[model samples]
Structures are given as structure tokens and as C-alpha cells.
Target: MIRTATPDDVPLIHAMVRDLAEYEKALDEARATEEQLREALFGERPAAFGHIAQDDDSGEVVGFALWFLNFSTWRGVHGIYLEDLYVRPEARGGGHGKALLRELARICVERGYERLEWSVLDWNEPSINFYKSLGALPQDEWTVYRLTDGALAGLGAAVE
Candidate 1:
């Protein structure tokens, strides 16, 4: 069973986020709090959306996917930028990942979104192959860039 997440799902979602961080070798940077997750997903203006997959028999959540909308100037249509997709190791290989991705695509088609995009770590060959099997291509022409902490804080000052 897959469905949109609600405020009550925060703790489970946070745990999944931490698990994904650990898997990606960034456990030290996984400092998200319950409050942050609640506000980001359930506030008056949601910053992102989340969906959970549960075990039908046990009624326990086994995986989740989180994403935000992004504008694509080239495509002239909004796209879903998947931020996280996770399934507990025990729950993997049961088609949960593909199911979650297919759900995202369904949402996109419903909303008339032109694209869906996400990034997987270079070392995660299984994920890369899975995505490729689904016909998702890597945007090799464009490189991603980021600035955190002090650099991000200085953006306003630098502009002025």
C-alpha cells in the first residue's frame, strides 16, 4: 500500500532519512530534527511532498519517497525533483522502489509535469542501473553545484 504521508508519519520518515544518510556515507551530516520535518512537509506552505509504502499485512511503513517541484526553463513545464527514495534493506528487492517511482510518474502525468529528475551517488551502481532500466538518463551536460553553511550565508552579502 502506497499513500501520501501525513504529519503523524514524521518520526518514521525521519528514521528513513537517517538510514538513507548512513547508506550514503553522510551519517555525520544527518542532523534533521522532527520539528524540521514537520514544518517542511505540513506547514501552510509545504516545501516538499512525501509518499510512503507500507506492508499490507503488518500495516507498517516499509519505504518512502520525497520530492519537490522544480521549473525547467527548457521544457517550459514543471518537473518533480526527487530528493529521497528509501526502502529498508529487509524490504528491498520486493519491487518497492519501482512502485514508488511509478507512483511519482503517475503524479507527474496527472499534473502535466514535463519531467522527473533525480540523482544517485556515483558508487550506487544498483540504483543507477534501476533508473536506467526505467529509461531515465543522466544529465551529463550539466554539473550540479552547491554551497553550504558560511558560503550559503554569505550569498546575500555578496550580492549587495
Candidate 2:
């Protein structure tokens, strides 16, 4: 079963996020606290939204997808930016990830989103193949950039 996540699912989401981080060999950077997730997802003003998939018989959460909306100037329509998709190791071949992605696609269609996008690590060949099979092509023309720590702080100072 796939459904919208609630505040009560924060712990489960946190655990799964850490699991995903570990799987990707980035556990050291995964530090999402329950309070942070709750406030970001369930506060008066939600910063993002998420959906969780559970095993119907066992009632255990097997996967989740988190996303946010973005505006595409070129397309002149909104798009969904999938931030995370994680399925338990034991549940990989069970179609949970596909189901979650399809669900998000449906939401995108219903909302008239211009596109759905997510990034996959270059080394994750399995995921790259899966996405290719789903007709998703990587946008190699654009490069992603980030500002962190002192760089992020320096941005404000530069404007002044």
C-alpha cells in the first residue's frame, strides 16, 4: 500500500533514510533528526511531501519517496523534483520502488507537472538502467552546483 506519510511515520522515515545513506556509502552525512523531519514535512507550512509504501500483510514500511515542486522556465509549468527514493534491501525486487515512482508520475500528470526529475549516482548502474528502461534520459547539458558551509554563508555577504 502506498500512502502519504504522516508525522507518526517520522521515525520510520528517518531509519530508512539512514539505511539508504549507508547503502550509498554516505552514512556519515545522513543526520536527519526526527524533529527536523516532522517540522519539514508536517508543520503548518510543509517544505516537502513524502509517500510511503508498506507491505500489506506484514504492515512494515518497505519504501518511501520524497519530493517537492519546482517551476520550469523553459516549459512554463511546474515539475516534481524527487529528492529521495528508498526501498529496503530485502524488498528490492518486489516492485515497491517502481510502484512508488509510478504513483509519483500519476501525481505529476494529475497536477499537470511539466516534468519529473531525480538524480542518480554515476556508479549506480542498476538505477541508471532502470530509469533508462522507464524512458528517462539524463540531462547532461546542465551541471548541478551547490554552496555549503562558508560558501553558503558568503553568498549573503557578496550581495552587500
Q: How much lDDT does each candidate structure score? A: 0.93, 0.90
> What's model 1's lDDT at 152?
88
Tens-digit lDDT track of model 1 for 28-141: 999989899999999989999999989778888999999999999998999999999999999988788888999999999999998989988989998999899999999888
> lDDT value for candidate 1?
0.93
Residue-wise C-alpha lDDT for candidate 2, range 28-105, written one tens digit per residue: 988889899889899989988999999878989999998889889999999999999999988887888888999999
**RMSD (Cα, Å) of model 2:** 1.3
Residue pairs of candidate 1 with colliding backbone atoms: none
In model 2, what lDDT does residue 75 have? 96
